[model samples]
Target: MKIMKTVQKVPGGMMVVPLLIGAIINTVAPHALKIGSFTTAVFSSAGVASFVGLQTFFVGTNLKFKEAPEALRRGSVLLVAKYLAGLILAIITNKIFGLSGFLGISVLAIICSVTGSNGSLYLSLMGTYGDSKDTAAQGILNIHDGPFLALITLGASGLASIPLLSLLAAIVPLLVGCILGNADKDLRDFFSPGASIVIPFVGFTIGAGINFSLIIKAGLSGILVGLLVFFVGGGLSILADRYINKRPGYAGAAIASAAGNTIASPAAIAIIDPKYKPFVASATTQIAAAVVLTVIIVPPLVAWMAKRYGCPKFDEQKAKNASLQES
Candidate 1:
């Protein structure tokens, strides 16, 4: 049946299909796999962070010491571009609608939802359409995964004491793996397969955390947030990659999706600032919808952009072959 080949033909299918399967399980039974032990661990929401951490470590192993500098530049540009997109739109939303935004969308939702990029999904996409250096840059994109960056940008930087450890906690695993891999080629090869191995699980765990019902609940406003995520994140980020980073912009487009962890950011921000408390529920739902939508939207966007710009996917010698034949 060529099952693996068939799956690979779908845009971001490796990650996306598992995510949808998990979402279906959650939506239907929602408790069938929560019986503890490895079953629950592998098939439920319990493994989200663990799977992501494991995936990050694997991605690090593929990166060479020589490529780290350019990876940093690419990753940093993506991080800034994603953040700025969220901040600009969020500030404009705030000016227009204030904290209690109209149609159930808030500044908090815009900031938290759009600013963060999905690291697991990015790694999977890069595996399909990018090279080792491009995937290694996931280490830097790891920083904005949770509430840390949004908190700082939300005026909490000066007044409130935010936890720097959360940010450190995300990056440290990737850094350690990179260090160990750079120190030993054998170790790098050993862990190299580990990243791709964990991808489907990462998607499943994250999807278990999501409820498709939220997309229905979010409605028009939710759809708007999702489109905002794709357009703003994709648009600005692609431009930043081309002009600022001086590279093909497929990477920026790839990273335009919301982080799976972002659904929690509204509540996290609300806890720190009571002003956001009233909007948390609505924002969370909207962000949840945005997360799902972007995962669907951005992958194909990246695939198309990669083909358009000639990215070097490890799996795609054909892309290179086509380039040579044309020349």
Candidate 2:
């Protein structure tokens, strides 16, 4: 069995499946893994925190500083649009619900979920339906690797008084890795796979921290947030790509999906502000669900938008492939 191929066939399966499996095991037998030996070393919350930090470092190494200016411009436009969408949502939600949150959803979670783009999904879609410039934008878009943006937005809103040093602490690993990677091509290649390889471990660790019951309560709210990410992110990106970037806007739709790493942001935020701890479990679950929801929904929407906007090669190939399968 082509296990890797099979797994890759499912949208976000690499991260999502491990997460679900971990969540189920942890839910059913919370104490089974706590045998006080090697099991504790690998799956404990401390272990997860280590992996999350390591993952951030790996992601930083993958950023290419010497990319074409056009790629940076395109990516910046999308990033700004995505950030603004989530910032607007956070501000509105804060005004209405304040720090207490509403209907099991917190402003912190809302900001994190909407602001971060699913780079994996975006790359997949862009590879198929977009141009080189579109795909290259991942370099700049990846800066949203951690919870820094969410924290920054919250601080800006006066909802939280996060220390500047804490904000720098969150970004320092990525910055160090970026400097090392930029200085050495070999180092970049070596650390690049670490980003992908560490995801399942991180996902499993995050899943184990969550309770399935919280997932059930947050599922619908997460789905609603995912839909909002799709439309608002998609709409703004399309406009930016067309007007600002002067390119076909397929990338806009492609990048509108919520990122898998977003599942970690809620917990990361909780670390920054203990006040957010109450919402962390539900927010984590909700963000995980949103990642899945957007992964499934955004690709088709991108294809449709591509067709409507007059990109036929992608759809033509897709139709050809589908017909070939029928034969």
Candidate 3:
């Protein structure tokens, strides 16, 4: 009962707390632990492992492989929209600004890929717009952005060189969790507590990337890029929510896109571009900024959009009706 009560109170508590702890450690003691690159890699690996374990424990309980096709289909559609949006924007910025080389292009791509944990938060906040299936799908889809960002930033040449084995090492556990969740409800319940633990780690790791120097270097150009990606990506997502989802009051979904998942981007970049360690600081700062912006801005915008568009309240009545019809 205590565990249940805590879980109820803090939905993503597990993920959020450790992340703050990490940030505090970074801020207070970055130099305290001078582990070599190998140790750093070990820490990173450990973090990923924790995340995968948490995901597996929760998702396994919720697994329903029979539903995999539908989930995959939805995930694929979202992936395409996400990648296409980022790629086009990056290309335009590169062409117009006369920016050359992978560095500039990669930075722009990273910005686009930084959509945060809004989908999970939206699932918690909106309460009615999404069902279990929608929530599950969002969880799975959220994991993809990191890998996709890595691929895009690396480009064709680096893409081939990227350590696929390492990438899969990070991704497979989460996938396994989701698959398990589809299969067993009890397992999902067991792992659910870990979600709160792992979720904030995502935030913290992303936050650790933030340093003052990189922000100064990025200056006005980086700020502009971040804003453009946030707004345009947001707008396109809104359109998709309306036309594709065909569900009323879908502004929450739009906000999810705008919320840019910054935490994963830095790690992705680190893995892809060893020479660009400093850029990780820039990515981190940008992600922190994006997180603040998304949390503050996206929710209100979604509410306003819903009201303006005459979106009906997603209440129990609607749910009951849908459930009955489906049954």
lDDT of 2 by residue, 236-318 (tens): 77788778877678787777777777788888778767888888877777787776667656766776677677453556778
- Flag regions of model 2 displaced more than 4 Å: 1-67, 156-217, 312-327
lDDT of each: 0.82, 0.70, 0.48
Alpha-carbon deviation at 7 in model 2, angstroms: 15
> Candidate 3 — what's its lDDT?
0.48
**All candidates: TM-score:** 0.89, 0.60, 0.55
Model 1 ranges off by over 4 Å: 314-316, 319-327
Candidates, ranked, TM-score: 1, 2, 3
**Distance from true position, residue 216, model 2, in Å?**
4.7
* Winner on TM-score (1 vs 2): 1
Candidate 1 local distance difference test against the native: 0.82
